[model samples]
Target chain A: MKKIFSILFVTLLLFSCQPDEIPPIGEATDYIPMLTGTWKLNKFEQIDADAESKSFPAFATVKDLTNVFPGHPYTDFSITFNPDGTFTADPGSSYMQMLTSGDWEVDDTEFPSAIILSSGSETQTIALNSLADVILGKVEFKEERKQADTGKIKIKYIYSLSKTSEL
Target chain B: MRQLIIISILIFGTFVLKAQDALPKFTVTPSEIDALTENVVIEFDVTGTAVEGLTDVYIWSWAPGLNPSEMLLCYDQGSPSWGSISDNAKLEPVAGQPNKFRLSLPKTVTRAGVEVTFNNVAELFGVGDTPGKIKEFGFLLRSQDGGSGGKQTPGDMKTSITLLPLEFEPSYFRTFPAKVSKNDVVTAYLNLSLIESSENQKLSVSDAFTATVSLLDENGTVLLTSEAFETTFTSEKEHAFSFIAEMLGAFPEGKSLDDVSKCQVVFSGKVYNQDESFETVSTKVFEFDFQDYE
Candidate 1:
C-alpha cells in the first residue's frame, strides 16, 4: 500500500511538471509584428446571420484603415499608437466614419490577447492561437459560435496585417 | 479527476491570456498644418501596436468659442462625425500604409485655436475598452497663425446702377422703360447692391453718393439728390440692397430742352466702413439718347 501511494505521488508530480496542453497551433506571439501596421478589411462574412452566403460585399476596400481585431469583433481593435498617448482607428467602410482617437492598455498574457482602450466606451479582446502569431501579424483560427437550432459551431476568420502607413 | 485538471488548465490559460492581451504600445507625433487662403489643414500620424475596429477622427478648433459642427470638417459618420477625405492612394496593403487623417476650417471664415482629435471610440468614452467593430478616435488640432493678414484690398465695396424704361404694365415687381421723351413724365428707377463681411463695414448713401441728373439746357441746375441709405443681411454671401433715385417732372412743361441728347444720369458714392477715417470715391455716368426716346 505504501509503495502504491509513493508511485501515485510521483505520477502526480510528473504531470504537474509538463506544460498545459495548449490549443492547436493557432495564433502566436510573432503575430504582433505583422499586426504592427494598418489593415483594411477588404472582405468579411456573416457566418451566423440568416443569410445563404457566408461572404458579402457589404464593406468597401478600406484604404484609410487605422485598426483591426484579431478574433473578437468590437472590443479588440487595432490602433496607431502615437507618442502623445493618442491613437487613430481604421475608418471602416461602414456608413459610420472610421478612425477614433484615444488611449490604450495591453494585457501581456498567453491565450486571450485582450487590450483595453481608454478615451472611449469600447473595450475588446482578441484570442490568438499561439505565441508565434502574436509577433507575426497573421492570425488564423476558428471562432466558436452557437446556432439557434444547431447549438455550437466554429467559424474561421483570417487576419493579414501590413505596415501600410509610415507616418 | 481528468475533468478537474482540464478546468484548472483552462482557467490558468485564461489568466495568462489576459496578461498577454495588455495594451499594444503606441505614440502620437505633432504634425504641421498649412494655412490656406480659404481654410486650414491639420495633419498627423500614429505608430506602434495595431489597435483595431477604430472608425472616427475628431478635430477640436481651438479658436474663440466655436460650434463643433463649424470647427470639425471631416470624421466617421456618427453624429458630429464625418468621413475621411483622402482617396485609396495611401491605403494599399502592399504599400506601407500610413494611417493619416486631416481636418480643415470652413472656407468662408477664418479662426485660430482649433484642436483635432484622432480617437477610437474607447478613448472618447475614457473606458479603456477594447476597440470593437465601430471604433472611434480623436485628434486635438490647434490652429496656428502663419499670420496671413487680412484682405489685400481693404473695404471691397461695389455698386451698380441699371436705368430701365418706365412700363405701364407690370408683373411681380413694377417694370420700367429704359428711355422716355422729354414731354413725357419720366420716372427713372435705380437699384443698388452691397457685400459686407463684418458689421463694422457700412454702406451709407449720402447726397455725396447721389448722381446729378440734367436735361439738355435746363436753365439752372436740375440735379436731384436722393435720400441716403444703408444695408445689412442674415446670409453670408452676396446680398441685394436697393435705393431708387427717381426724378419726375414734365419736360419743362411743354418746351423740351434742346439737344436733349445731353440728358444724363450721374452716379456717385464713397465707400466707408464703421471708422469714417478711410474712404474711397467712385462714380458712374449714363446718358439718355433722345433719338430713341419714347
Candidate 2:
C-alpha cells in the first residue's frame, strides 16, 4: 500500500515539471481589450516631416530616443488605460507630453486605427500604426503635429509601448 | 624619415587648400538669366582675391561653346584685338566699397576709361549673322594687368551659363512639384492641342495621342518606364498621369529609393497617322530643361 502511494506521488511530481500549456485563443475584441492595461514607453521616434516635404536630403532627420540623453527627459513614462474608457499616467522622473491622460477611446473596437483622447474642450488624435499584439504585449501609436494655420504636417512622433501589467 | 614625409605632405596640402579658398567668388545678380534675358549684372566680392584693396579691376569674357574664343573684343573699335583688351577691360568700382567692382553687360553706359558701346548681346559677343548655341558666357576677373605681381581670380571662377528653355510650339510639356524625390508622387503633363491644322487632322483620324514617361538615372539611362496614357484633342489639351517616383527602379534587396543618385524625368509623346492605321506619324521627346538637383 505504501509503495502504491509513493508511485502516485512521483507521477504527480513529474506532470508538474512539464511546461505550461496555453489554451487556444480566439474571438478577441482585439484592440480595446488589449489596451486596458498598464503600458511603459519603450521607445520614442520623431521625424521632421516639414523638412522632408521640402525634399531636403536630410529627410532622415529622425530621432529614436532609446538611450536617454542628458537634459532630455524622455524616459520613465507610464500610462494606464481602463476598460471604462478612463485613463491615467505617471510622468515619473521624465517629462511626458500631458496629452495622454483623460477619457480615451479607440476609433474602433475591433481594429482601431487611432486613439482619440479628450481632455475638457480639446481633443487630440494618435494614429495606431498597427494592430495591437496581445501575445507580444506591444502596441504602436503615432502622432503628427501640424502647423495650425497651414494644416501641414510638421513633425511625426511614434510611441512604442510595452504592456507592464494588467489594469 | 616616414614621419617627416607625412608632416611635409600635410603642410603642403594645407597650403594648397588655403590658396583655393582665397580665390575670388563671382556672384551674378539674378543668378539665373535665361538666354533671352538682357541687362546682365556682375558683382565681384573681392574680399579674398589675390589682389589687395582692388584698386583697378578688369574683365575678361569668352563664348563657352564652339571654343574658348574671346568675346566682347571691342578693345580697339575699328581694329579690336585680344592684345588691346588691357586698355578697354577695366571695370568701374562700386561707390564707397573698396573690395567691390561691378560690370553691366550689353554695355548700356560708357565707363570713364573704357571706349566701347555694345547695344545688345550680339554686339557685345560679336555673334554677327551666324547663329549657334552659346551655352555660357565665360569670364575671369583680373587686376588692371594680369601680369606678374597682379591680383586675379583663379581659372575655376567662370560665369554661370544660361540655356534656352526647350519649347516646341503649339503643344507643351511640364512637370509639377519642381523638386522631385524617390518617394513623392510625380505628375507628367503633355499639352495635346494638336492645335496645328495638320496635327489636329492626324489626331482626329486616330483615336488619341499616346504619351509615355521614363525615369532616368544620372547617366540618362532609362531606369523604369510607365504605361502609355492617351488623350484626345476634343477632350482636353492638358493630359497628365501621376505616379510615385520610387516605383521606377528595381533596387537590390535592402537598398531603396534613397539610394537613387539622380532623379530626372524624360517624357515623350506620339501622334498617330491620319489613316487610322495606328502607325506612329510623329514622336516628340522632351526633357525638364531646367536644372534638376543631382
| Top candidate, metric lDDT | 2
- Stretches > 4 Å off in candidate 2: A1-167, B1-21, B66-68, B77-83, B108-116, B119-122, B128-131, B156-160, B165-294
The positional error of residue A160 in candidate 2, measured at the CA in angstroms, is 82
* Structure candidate 2, residue pairs in collision: none
Residue-wise C-alpha lDDT for candidate 2, range B165-202, written one tens digit per residue: 32222345544433334443344555544434444344
DockQ of each: 0.01, 0.01
Local distance difference test scores for all models: 0.33, 0.58
lDDT of 2 by residue, A32-117 (tens): 77788998888877655533432333313454544433343455888888889988878765545556578999887777788888
Top candidate, metric TM-score: 2
**Cα lDDT for residue A85, model 1?**
46
lDDT of 1 by residue, B1-294 (tens): 999999999999886565333322222222221111123333333222121222232233211222232222332233342223212112112124344444333322111233333232222222212112112222232112112421111111111111121112221111012223343223232333331233223333432343345555444344333332322221322111222122223454544444344455544456645787556443344455433221
